[model samples]
Target: MGTITALGLLLLICMVVVGGTQGLQAWISLIFNFAALFFAMVLMAFHLSPVLVTLVTGVIVLAMTIFLGGNDSNSTMVAFYASVAVLILLVILIIPIEHWAQIQGFGQEDSEDLEGMSTILGISYLNVAVSTAILSTLGAIAEAAIAIAAGLAEILEQHPKITLKNLQGAGFKVGSQIIGTTFNTLFFGFFGGFLALFIWFAGVHYSLGEILNDKILVGEVLMVLFSMMSVIATIPLTTWAMVASERQARKKFVK
Candidate 1:
C-alpha cells in the first residue's frame, strides 16, 4: 500500500478506537482541512493574491476544525469569531513588523536553491512573506480559539448560574492551565519540524551569526513568534467572546 493510504488507514483505525463516530467526523474535518490548504496553494500558484488565499483558507480551516470537530454551534461560532478578530489584529501587527524586519525574498545562501527561476514571475516576495506568516500562525490561532471557547462553554454548562465576572475569572484560570502546554506544543512542534534543517546547518559548519542572520531562519523564527502572539491573544479574546455570548443568551431568554 502507498504511504499516504497506509497513514489514512491507520488514522481511521485509531480514530475508531478512540472516539468512534466523533472520531470519524474529526477525521473527515481533518481531511477537509488538508484539502482547503491544497486548494489555497493551487490558487496561489495561479497568481491569485496570497493574502486573499490566506484569508479564505483561514475561514475554511476554522469552520472545519471547529464545526466538524464535534463542536456545537455556539462553540463553533465563538471559535470562529474570536479567531477572526485575533487574526485581524495580528495581521495589522505583522505588516509593520515584517517590513521593519527586512527579511523578505531569498538570501544569498538561497541563491543556490533558486538557480533558474525567472524574476518575471511577478510575485511580490514581501507579500509572500506576509502570507506565509499568516498561514503559519493560523492553525495555532484556530486551535487556541477552539480550545478556549470549548473550555469556557463547558464551564458555563457546569455552572449555569455563574456571573460574567466569575466566568471571566474561571476562563482565565482555565486559560492558564492550557497556556503552558500549548506553548510547549508550539515550541516542540517547531523543533521537530525543523530538526533536519538544524542538522543541515550544523553539517555545513554554519556559524552562530550566520545561522541567526539567515533569511529562512529569521522568517521561520518570526513565524513562530507571530503564532505564539496569536495564541496568547486568542485566550482572552475567546473568553470575552464566550462571556458576551452567554450574556446575550441570558438576556434573550429572560424576554
Candidate 2:
C-alpha cells in the first residue's frame, strides 16, 4: 500500500480499537470532511464564485461533522444550527478584517516564488484570501459548537432534573476548558506548521520586526486570531443555543 493509504488504515485500526463504533463514525466523517475541502478547491480553481464555494463546502462539512461524527439526530440538529449561527456572525467580522489586513498579493520578496506564474489569473486574490480565512475559521467554529453541544447533551442525559442555571454554569465551565485547549492547539499548530519557514528566516538573518511585518506572516497571524475569536464566540453561542433549546422542549412537554 501507498504510505498515505497505509497510514490511513492504521488510523482506522487505532480508532476502532480505542472507540469502537464511535471511532469508525468519526473516521468516516473525517474522510467526508477532507472530500469537502477537496471539492471546494476544485470548484474554486474552475473560477467559480469563491463565496458560493465557501458556503457550499461549509454546509457539507458541517453536515458530515455533526451527523456522521456519532452524534444522534437531536445533537446533530443542535450542532448544525449553532454552527451555522456562529458562521454567519464570523463572516460578517471576517470581511472587514480581511480588507484591513491588506495582505492580498505576493510580496516583492516573494518574486522568486512567483517567477513562473502569470500576472493575470483573472481572479481577485483578496477574495481568495477572505475565502480562505472564512473556510479555516469555519472548521474551528464547527468543532467548538459540536463539542459544546455534545457535552451539554450528555449533561442533560445524566442529570435530567438539572436546573437551567446549573446547566448554563456547566456549559461555561466546559467552554472555558475548550477555549484554553483550542487556543493552544491553534497557536502551536501554526508554529509547528511553519517551523521550516522559521528556520529559513533565521538562516537568512531576517529580523524579528521584518518577519512580523511580512505580508504572508501577518496574514497567517490574522487567520489564526480570526479562528481563535470564532472559537471563543462559538462557546457562548453554543451554550445559549443548548440551554434555550432545552427550555423550549421543557415548555412544550409541559403544555
Give TM per candidate: 0.92, 0.92
lDDT of candidate 1 over 16-67, digit per residue (tens): 8999888998889878888887888788878899887888788777777777
Clashes of each: 0, 0
Q: Model 2, 9-83: lDDT tens per residue?
A: 999999999999999988898888888888888888899988778877887787777777735677668888888
Strongest candidate by lDDT: 1
Instruction: Kindly report which residue pairs in candidate 1 clash with one another.
Output: none
Superposition-based RMSD of candidate 1 using all C-alpha atoms, in angstroms: 1.8
